[model samples]
Target: MRSRSSNRFSRPSAQRGVALVIALVLLVLMTLLGLTSMRGVALEERMTGNTYDRSLSFQAAESALREAEALVEANRPTPAALAACVNGICGSPNPADLERWLDPAFPSPPNPGGWQAATQVSNGPISLTPQYIVEYLGDTFPCQPGNPASTNDCKRYRITARSAPGGDRSVVMLQSVFATD
Candidate 1:
């Protein structure tokens, strides 16, 4: 039998650097995995930020809509001008304006002819200024008996409000109808 000392160091030389090579390969693969994970996280963060901006824009639009409705309600004494409306419905996209507020295909400007710039809205806080139009839907039939004094000369108004976030292409549009006294 061979001496114990001779057998102890007689292992194959080819395996000497195999462990080191395996360790380096593993390290490279782990680094690649880490980079991929980081990229995914970054993308998610961007998406979340966009969602927040969209929310803000929608809220602003809703606020504008309420304001327009209130204004129409306040005009209780005098009747709204129907001749100024586009087809007697859209106040801004009137026949004289270059852009049509009611048309989705048209890129509506904030200040179309008869459109009134919204007041009580902070221009700096909101991305886009809100605009409103008061359309007068002609006479309405009496909802009750044939009493002339009881007949209500009700007028209909259509209000449209738009809001958008800064640096984002997304926009929010809100529209509502209101009846006058």
Candidate 2:
């Protein structure tokens, strides 16, 4: 009869480290997954910060626009002064005269020729103060052809406001038309 030791179950020496190799592979995969999720979270955080900054810029621009409108309502500038664009009140009536407002470089550093800085009392975190420009779009006559003598002549004005936050990283601009009594 054969001895029990002679028929004992045994593994090859080469396969002794198989379990260790499998454990190492699993550990590497887990580490990669964790790193990927961390990157995703970091990206989401940056996006949220950008959104909030843009919202603040837009609000600052709107406040400047309202201030310009108030200025126009309080004291109307003469057409001659507006024609010369004195103190940011422009009445040139030429569409090209207002082209500078669209120029990215024009307002970033501020052009003393036309931009008017707003005195907005900001209670939030904003990088730069808002600014505005006023353009007179000429007078509008409400009288029809048959009623040429109608006394209602309204002066139309276009107000443009801009805000640059984070050193021009984000810029917000707004425009509105206002009529005077």
TM-score of each: 0.66, 0.77
Q: Number of the top candidate by TM-score?
A: 2
- How much does each candidate deviate from the true structure in C-alpha RMSD? 5.5, 3.7
Assess candidate 1 and give its TM-score to the true structure. Answer: 0.66
Among all windows of ten consecutive residues in candidate 1, which has the lowest summed lDDT? 85-94
Which residue runs does candidate 2 get wrong by more than 4 Å?
Answer: 1-16, 96-98, 104-111, 120-127, 141-151, 165-168
On lDDT, the leading prediction is 2
What TM-score does prediction 2 earn? 0.77
Task: Give per-residue CA lDDT, model 1, range 78-133, as digits (tens).
Answer: 34443444311343234454544556444334434455555444435545565555
Q: Native-vs-model 2 lDDT?
A: 0.74
Model 1 residue runs over 4 Å out of place are 1-5, 8-12, 76-82, 85-99, 102-114, 120-128, 141-150, 164-169
- Model 2 worst lDDT window (10 residues): 104-113
Model 1 per-residue lDDT at 76: 35
Q: What is the lDDT of residue 133 in candidate 2?
A: 82
